[model samples]
Target: MRLGNVSLPVLASAVLCLGALISPAHAVPSQPWYLAAFDHVMRVLVNNEAPAVQMASGSAEQQNNVDPAYYSRVTKEAGTITLRGNVPSDGDLKVLQGVAAAIAPGASVVDRTRINPGVPNRDVWLAAMTFALRQMGKLNTGSASLRNAAITIEGVTNADDDFAVIQKKVREEAPKGLNLQVALKPHDVRPFVWLAQLQQGAVHLSGHVPSEQDKVIFGHAQVLFQNLTINSSMEVAKGEPKGWIEATKVSLEMLSLLYSGSVAISDKVVKIDGIYSSPAMVDLLKVYSKRLPEGFTLETSILEPVARAPAARAEDMSFAAHQARASYNP
Candidate 1:
C-alpha cells in the first residue's frame, strides 16, 4: 500500500541500497602484483627498463637514486607536448616540466625521460633555451642544441620586433662564439619600417615589405582614419626594405599615439609630418633611418587631410519646386 507519496516496497528498496553503499571493499597489493602494475605503466618508455637503469650514481640526488643526466627533447606539435631524453637534476626536470605543463595544460605528463649526470657547460645552453622559450609568444615549437664550444639557436616569434629583441638577448647572454639564428614566422601588426604619407589629404603607404605586411599596417592606419577617407596605395612585394620591420613597428606605435600625420621611411632617413605633437618620434625613427637601403635620402612632406565641413540641412517642408543654384563659385 502507499504511505503518503511512498510505499512499503519502495522503503525496503532504499534500505537495501543503503546497505550496499555501506559495504567495505579492501585493496591489498602483493610484491609481485605491484611490480607488474609498474611494468605495465612503463612498458613503452624509451629509457625506463631493466638492466639499463637510470644513471644517477653520484650527484645531488644520488641518495634518492635520481640521475642528473642532461639531454632533453621538448617539442610541442599539433597541440601535443612531447618530452623525451634524460634530465641532469630535478631543477632541469622542473624547468622542462614547467614548459610542458604550459604547452599542454590539464594534460598528462607522458614522461619517457631518464636521469643521468649531465656534461660540462650544460647550464649555459639550458639557461639560454629556457629563456628563449619563455620569451617567444604564442606557439612554443623549436629545437635547441649545445655542442662543441658553440651554441646554435634557431627559433621563430610571432612579431618581427620580438624575434629581433629575443635574438639580441640570447646572443648577448650566451658565451662568446654563440651562433644564433632567429626569424619571425608571420610578423605581427607592428608599425615597423614602412611609410604612411598623408599627401593631398590622401593617405598613401608605400615601402618594400613582406606581402602580408601591407594588410597589418593598413589595418592600424585605418583605425586612425575614423570618418576620414583613406587612399591605400601600399604595395605588397616579396621582401621588405632593409630595416623595414623595425621602422614599421615604430611607425605603428607613432600613429597609435598621434592623431594625424605622415611617416616616411627609407634606408637613409625617416621623415614625418604633423609630428609637432611629439618631436621625440623623430629621434626614435633615426635608428631605422640610418640603415637606408643602398641609395636613399631624407625626405619630408605632408598634405594635411582637408576637413570636409558638413553642409547645413534646410528643412524641405515638402516643397514643390526647389531651385538648385551653382553651389560652388570657383
Candidate 2:
C-alpha cells in the first residue's frame, strides 16, 4: 500500500532500526550512512513540520517538544471580525470566539484558530486575548495581535472618546504577563504640526494642539518658561498622535532650557533648534528626551558657548588711563 502520511517519530524510529542493522563499526566511510540519514531527516522535519509532526507523535513529551506557546490574532474591519492563530484547546477557542462576539455585537465573528495544547500560561494568554479584542472593538478599523507573550493593538478612529477607552484599557486592564503595545491613530488623515519659539523672554506657540489639551499645554509652557510671555497662535484640532501631549510637554521642557531656540513638531517627529548656555542644558535635554512617550522621535540643534568679548592689552589700558587723566586735568 502507498504511504499516505508519515509521522516524524515513526520515520525516525525506522531510520534508527535500519542503522542498527547496518553496523556502523564495520563501515568504511568516516561518516556512517544511518547517522547522516537521521540528521537530514530531523533537520527537514524540525524546520518544515515541527508543530504538526510533534503533535501527531501521540506522546506527552513529544507534544511539548516544540515551543510551549500559542499565537492568537484578531482583526476587525468592514463590520466583520476575523480571528486567526493557535489556542490551547477547543474550549479556549470557544472562549476567544465568545470574547470576539461579545466585544463586537451584531458584527460577524469568524474563528480560524487551531487547538494546540502546549500553551505555557493559559490564564495569561486568555487575558491577553480578551484585552486585544476589547481594544480592537473600540476602533473603527483595527487589529490586535498576540504572538507568544507580546500583545499589540493598533487602530484608527475619529472619536477621541473611543481613543480614550483604548488608552484606559491599556493603562488599567492590561494583562500582567504579556507586553502590550498601542498604536492608535486618528481617522483624520491630516498631518499634525506644532511650533514653539523662545526669544527675548517670550515664547510663541503655534500650530495644532488637541482640543482637550490646549489649556494644559499652554499652561505647561507658561510654567516652564516662568515670567515669560506665552504667545499662543496654536489652533485647536484633532488627529494628534497617541503620544502627542506627552511629547509636546517634553519638547517644551527641552526648549525652556535653551537661551533662544525653537521647537517644531511635525507628525511624530520633534525638531529642536536654538542656542544654550551651559553644557548641563544639553545633558538635561538628553535626560528629558528619554521621557518623551513612545512612538515619537526627537531631533535637536542648539547653539552654545555664549560668544565672549576679547580682553584688552596692558599698553592699551595704560594709554586709556593717561588719556582719561589728561581730559580730567584739562
lDDT of each: 0.47, 0.74
The candidate that achieves the highest lDDT relative to the unseen native structure: 2
lDDT of 2 by residue, 191-279 (tens): 77888877656888877777568789899998888899999866655668998998999999998887666788888988877666477
Worst-scoring 10-residue span by lDDT in model 2: 321-330
Model 2 clash pairs are: none
Q: Where is model 1 more than 4 Å wrong at Cα?
A: 1-71, 99-112, 135-140, 159-163, 169-184, 187-208, 211-330
Write one digit per residue (lDDT tens) for candidate 1, span 1-330. Answer: 444587745755665455456424422334333334444434424344533342332355444552233345544444455556655666776787687566457645455666554444455646654643443324434444434234344444333243334455655655454455444343434333445644233555654456556677777667765555566655433334465665565554454333345565544355544432245545554564464444456554322223333221112201100111111000
